[model samples]
Target chain A: MDGIDKTDRKAINFSEKLERISDLWQPRVIAEMNDYQFKLVRIEGDFVWHDHPETDETFIVLEGVLRIDFRDGAVQIGPGEMFVVPKGVEHKPFAENEVRLLLIEPRGVLNTGHAGGNRTAQNDRWV
Target chain B: MDGIDKTDRKAINFSEKLERISDLWQPRVIAEMNDYQFKLVRIEGDFVWHDHPETDETFIVLEGVLRIDFRDGAVQIGPGEMFVVPKGVEHKPFAENEVRLLLIEPRGVLNTGHAGGNRTAQNDRWV
Candidate 1:
């Protein structure tokens, strides 16, 4: 009883966990590895331009298309693809359609990063 | 040119990277975030029983099925599913068919972990 429970040992399914999220842009924690957290988020439209000065952020597309626009260029990520945004680099994410994403970064990382505002979601919200 | 190059900023496609791997059990690094790395691997049959004493390992299944057997039980991961094998927890991975996986772990961690053997692949082999 002190060790991992049977439920905790089960695999984390993206589609199953995603069904619990009803809001857009708000990320829900699905799993963790060391100090990092794997978050599932549904996003559409455009996101604020920001940068994590302390750590890099990873974006893995599970469904739809996601385009991250940088100062100089942009990268489009579809399902089955991923992109890593380096620390201190400013970028904005845009999706014309609803996109399901798996974001990986250190715990306590803000969705808005340094560009804090109303767009900043409550951190550590697990589904 | 001191910053990220155009080619480096492109999205990393899992399927495209996986096509280059012709061997089983050998993982090829596709991208890196901070000190961590994202690797794509094709695995079948069984793997060595091992444990990483220093860090946890993440397995995201892209195709086929993957079963990680723990001391108490086992967890099966399929496409769009993931499991984090905690550090120092001995486990063995078994696949009935070819399983394409995306592995996330700190740089320098081997496929066999502390259980060094013929299954130990050359570290840092990038696709």
Candidate 2:
């Protein structure tokens, strides 16, 4: 079928997703569709408190234990677990062990959580 | 802390994504944001050749080997690998072993590949 279309989404591998992030706290984009982007991040220990003001972000844990502390409730996401933090809701993420996670969010989302800091990354650094 | 915004995307689990699908050849919507949708599918043997006329689809292989036969060449993707089939391209997927995958594409994507089939499904199924 020369002109037949595959309605199925093309497959993307995770190892390549891992190749994009080299350090903790920094995330690099692996793929993008329309206005949304998929990112991969490696983390260990505590990260600064932050929030995206305009978009909700989704996290899928491929490895390790991850904890998210919110005002009313906190959630611990382990291997295979995912959570979405609503936009503008304050939260902090901490991982005692090294973790590999996939993030889906909009483009230009700040890494420092919100606004500015020396921790804020200007451009995505690929691994 | 009571008011810290978590910077990490809240984690969403895959087992839960699996619970959303019930049969083979059928794809179920597990989650969505904006115009894009995340789907889970269980597939086996040969599927009808088809394509998405508008949006490019993304596939992430969670288990088993999947073959996407393109016009000029074909690719076999296994666990942890992914492939993005460009839009308006003719292709068919097949698996000798049962395959589980994640589909990330736009809403209202036709399952029969490009158009109508006795197999075309409407409304996402939740298992």
Best by TM-score: 1
Comparing to the true complex, what docking class would candidate 2 get?
acceptable
DockQ of every candidate:
0.60, 0.33
Best by lDDT: 1
DockQ of 2: 0.33
List native contact recovery per candidate, as a fraction of 1.
0.66, 0.40
Residue-wise C-alpha lDDT for candidate 2, range B50-123, written one tens digit per residue: 88777677787888899988866678888876676667887788899999987787787887666577767675
TM-score list, all predictions: 0.97, 0.82
Candidate 1 local lDDT, B1-127, one digit each (tens): 1246767878999999999999999999999999999999999999989999899999999999999998889999999999999888888999999999999999999999989989999999999
lDDT of each: 0.94, 0.73
Model 2: lDDT of residue A32? 69
Alpha carbon lDDT at B100, candidate 1: 99
Model 2, A1-127: lDDT tens digits are 1243344334566776676556677787777655667777888987777877777777877788989777666789998666777677777788989988878877878776665777676555443
Provide the lowest-lDDT 10-residue window in model 1 chain B. B1-10
